[model samples]
Target chain A: MISKVGRHSIRLVSELGELAGFSGKASVALPGQRHIMEKLTRSIFEIGVRCVPITLIVGLFTGLVLGLQLYYVLTKFSSESLLGQAVALSIILEIGPVFTAIMIVGQAGSALSAEIGIQRNAEQIDALHTMQINPIGFLVSPRLWAAIIAFPILTTFFDLIGIYGGYLTGVELLGVDPGAYWNRIYEAVSVQNIVNGLLKALVFGIVTTMICAFQGYYTHLKSDIPGARGVSQTTTRAVVYSSIAILMFDYLITSFQMAS
Target chain B: MSEATTLKLRGLKKAFGEQVVLGGIDMDIPLGSHTTVIGKSGTGKSVLLKCISGLMAPDAGSIAAGDEKGAPPCSYMFQQNALFDSMTVEENVALPLREKGKAKATEIKKRVSDLLEQLDLTAARKKYPAEISGGMKKRVALARALITNPEIILFDEPTTGLDPQRKYSVFDMIRSYRKRFGFTVIMVSHDVPEVFEISDKIAWLDAGEIKYWGTPDDLLANPPEDLKPFLNPQLSPA
Candidate 1:
């Protein structure tokens, strides 16, 4: 049992190291990549524009639920006017970035992983190498750049829509003073809070995108299975691992911010 | 290595774990000649081709280009015709040039158009790989491989899942293109007498070694003892 535990620990560390190296190489290759703006635009369309509807739907519902629950809780303490502060802080600082990332993972990250996995299985990657092309530069660097540009933008959208959902529930439906709610939100949210939230989104974007791409790129070598089954397995792992990384990094970033 | 030689392999060795693939392969491929390496299913013909193409590094050996230059540029046509499904046929054919970024957009377009016209792929230029037939995919792959005007081209089982007629057509296309382009061809194939038709030299790989290397007629006139069983399965000691 001890030996087995030790073996798994070592494997985990080794995989983490490999993931870091993969991300580093992809990042380094970014400057020299050809037709990068075109590729980056396509990636942004896939990862950002296509994900808007789902992100908005999830964001609105989360705000509505928070508004409904927090109104009653504030009423218990005769603090109903604090609803805006609560909603804005929750959406901007935590829910917005986290949910946006998870939704993108379900849609764009999974697709990226599967596409790359299929390419690997079909020997298209090897074909590129034989053609004297850098596979990572051609295949991955644009996606990374797209994620960096898209994540913060999506998170901002989620936050604005979520705050509106809260306003509808807190001021229009419930009976809190609109001026008080808006004023509380204005006074409560500082530049630092918004900056911290966007920073989290940026970090989550880089980490999750790298994890998904890494998993798919090395699917053939990593999976015990082969062919379509192997592609499926690695793609599933990509989604799961990316989602987990988002949450884990959220905690680490949150804790670090709080400490400092 | 003679100036006539385009590629030379000396003591090329590769093994996966304990299973030895290519034990010690030594061979020279002449410039502008078609050489096919034929062997049984598990005898590592693909492995040897990959090693030569720099797709897979050998465990212990040196692969040399005969030119004074360090290593000649090579293009590989994979067994499955690994064309990018997401890219249209024209885009697929032009990808290597586009990635290399050495040519302008107009030049790339002209070169791709010419190659596609030559390969009878102009009609399918806008279609994706999934939309095209297998033979057309092979031609597109060939166009991509030939676009850079590589000094050497490595083909890995270029006709694995094709009918005999299509297979023969692919071989004819390869032979005709080789003559036109003057590029040396190193192919791994299993089409037996069919493959011998286009090959200038045939290297028989078995037991992790090159057991026979000669012209097709030479191999047929005096087949080695071990190769005879493979050449004519009825001669096997069943």
Candidate 2:
């Protein structure tokens, strides 16, 4: 009999192999431009359009809190003029991408998992296979590409709103000179910083959606769970795993940038 | 003997770990004929169909189709109907055509509408799978399977969970369509008498093998010892 650690190691290796294979296959299973357009539009509506109001609200509140907190911290060092710089840096470098990713994983990723899981249970995936349709290309790749397109757009919206929220708190509420605030923010944030945040969002979106879709695809293959119970558990696990993957990859990418 | 052997299974074997499902199965499904496979639960009835349909590979043995050069398109109507809940009835029927890209959108729409009408599912064409009844779902699945104009159609207990009337209606629909399409039909079923009515041949699987293969009359007139109890339960000292 294999030891407990050995069994777990085998399972982990198997999962990693499956992830690699699925990513490779999905990359090549390109749908036609017309098919892509149809899928992407529906996906953007579900994943991006629906999350706008909540993301906007969250961005504004997070920026307001960050600005108020930073003012007091900087005031002690006679550097309250740096309030905009701090808030802008945090939003662009970390908060915008990370928050948007978490939101997408919660909203879109969970639903994707549940939808695919139900399809699997209902034998719809097998039906597609029998019809000679590539189930991954039809069901999965569209969502992955859609998330890639949607994530950067959502992040841009989040950053702009967050910056405005910071401006409100710093210039209008805290009596920081509006000119100083605007000047510091403009000096602190560059095109590279905006591009970096967008890159993070893109990676996070791809990794999170891939994980969710993979989990959904393999839900029936999991022996320990079956039927509706498997569907529910897999949905929850998809959300949790995608969230953790986003944070972990975020740190890893940031570390790589820092080291380079 | 009149119909050619469209599908031939020889020494087909499959197992899950130590538990062997199909130890070795050999059978021939003739072209343009309806064949019913009857077996107790867990006897690998569906497994055999899966292997024949190329959905699952046999651990050992060969399944040779009539065409040695190319595989004729085949469709399987799953026991659960397997209709996409998100799609309307007509969309579900049109899926195979769209997937194959053999026809334009207008052509696909026309074919789907005609199929819906023929299947008496025109009223449900705009309704999603969830909005339809089990009988309607079965007919929808049949329309989807027939849309591709496949040479072989595998039915996995298509009428398993329906009332007696619904079951008979489904059988009637299959009979009428088979007369028109003349596709080879291989079905796994638990409904003995009803399925026998539509089947030209019957194969009874027991203990991981085809214990009997012949016409329904032959099976009733000369059943093997192992199958006697199953064929006539009243005679046994129960």
Candidate 3:
């Protein structure tokens, strides 16, 4: 029994190694110029175009809430007017990256995982390999490139809408001075803060999409199992892992920024 | 029975955590040949195909193509059409070519049209896989496989779950296309006699080993009761 268990351990490691090698081969096998165009268009449709209205709606509400909440709390300190800086800092640094990524994990990441997983289960990836078409180039690279390009842009959009919402609350609703609000926000927020937030979003996008894709792609490793249980497990694990990873990464990045 | 293409698999082995799927498989899938592998369910017929296609690499053994690269890209027709539910029949057929950029949009559309016409699925081209019938879905998969003008096509239980009419029709389609294209057709199926009709050689796999490998007539006359079950499996779906 002991020997049998030992043998199994060795076998699992070897399979994992092979999978890694295959993944590496796939990553290097890039699509042609035209295929890249199609992938880019698809990414725009999936990540940017489809995500815009949702991001705007969500971002705006979050900003408005942040402003209202901050105004109520800072009123005790005779600083209700500081609502502008509070909302801006929160949206620009924390809420924008985290909330946007989680939202995308639901929207884009889930879609990506489901699509790639179904393909893997259906043997389409195998078909690609047999055809000498690199599945990585055909599947993974487009997604990697898309997340790298789209997430930062999406995060920026989220931040903008959120700030606008907070601005609306502070100026139109709360009767805080507009000039004072912008001045406070501009004074507290710097280019480095913006860069840090955008960078976090970019990294989160890649990590979230990749984990989901990998989970989906390797799902059929447990072949012969009936039902969508495997798919369910993969999707759940993807979200959980991605969220934890994003948080861990967020702290590290913030620390780096603070130190430097 | 032998053909130009040579796919050599030596010391081919694969295993799950505690289960050994393909113990040690040595096979040659030649070009211009119709080889059908019959085995019990869960006996790794599909796994063997996956290994050969490089979808699931075996723990041991090496699969190498003796033919030239881009010698008609080998297309795999999965047991279940494996159609992208999202894409139209035309898009599904165009998938590989679209990825490879082997043809312009006009040419792709043209080729897709021709395939649809040939398979009598022209009217269904705009429909998604879910919207189409199971038989139609299988045909769409076949169309997709043919779209690449493959060097060889590996089919996993090509007619496993179809109705009688669709099953025989699928058989006819598989045979006629192989003749027309002169491409190697390697199929892993349990449809015993139907496979025999199309197969130039038969390899009966049992428990991760090739128990029997010969021509249909050779096996029929000197019948093994072991292979008899596969000789006439219920064509109806389970």
The global C-alpha lDDT for each of the candidates, from Candidate 1 onward, is 0.91, 0.86, 0.79
Off-target runs (Cα >4 Å) in candidate 1 are B1-4, B67-71, B234-238
Which regions of candidate 3 fall more than 4 Å away from where they truly are? A1-34, A222-226, B1-20, B23-30, B56-73, B225-238
- What tens-digit string does per-residue lDDT give for candidate 2 at A134-240? 88888888888888889999998999899888888888999999889889989989898888899999999889888888888878985258998998888898898
> CA RMSD for every model?
2.0, 2.4, 4.6
Query: What is the lDDT, from 0 to 100, of the residue B74 in candidate 2?
Result: 80
Cα displacement (angstroms), candidate 3, residue B188, comes to: 1.6
Which residue pairs clash in candidate 2?
A: none
Q: Which candidate should be chosen as best, given TM-score against the real structure?
A: 1
By lDDT, the candidates rank as 1, 2, 3
Candidates in order, interface RMSD in Å: 0.6, 2.1, 2.6
lDDT string for model 2 (B1-238, tens) is 2223567788999999999999988887777889999988899999998888888888998877654522356899999999998889988999888877759999999999998888899999999998988888998999999998888889999888789899999888888899988788899998876787899999999889999999988877777888876677633444
Q: Which wins on lDDT, candidate 1 or candidate 2?
A: 1
- Which residues of candidate 2, in runs, are more than 4 Å off? A32-34, B1-4, B67-71, B234-238
By DockQ rank, best first, the candidates go 1, 2, 3
lDDT of 1 by residue, A219-260 (tens): 998788999999889999999999989999999999999999
Candidate whose DockQ is highest = 1
Q: Would you list the clashing residue pairs of candidate 1?
A: none
Error of 2 at A150 (Å): 0.8
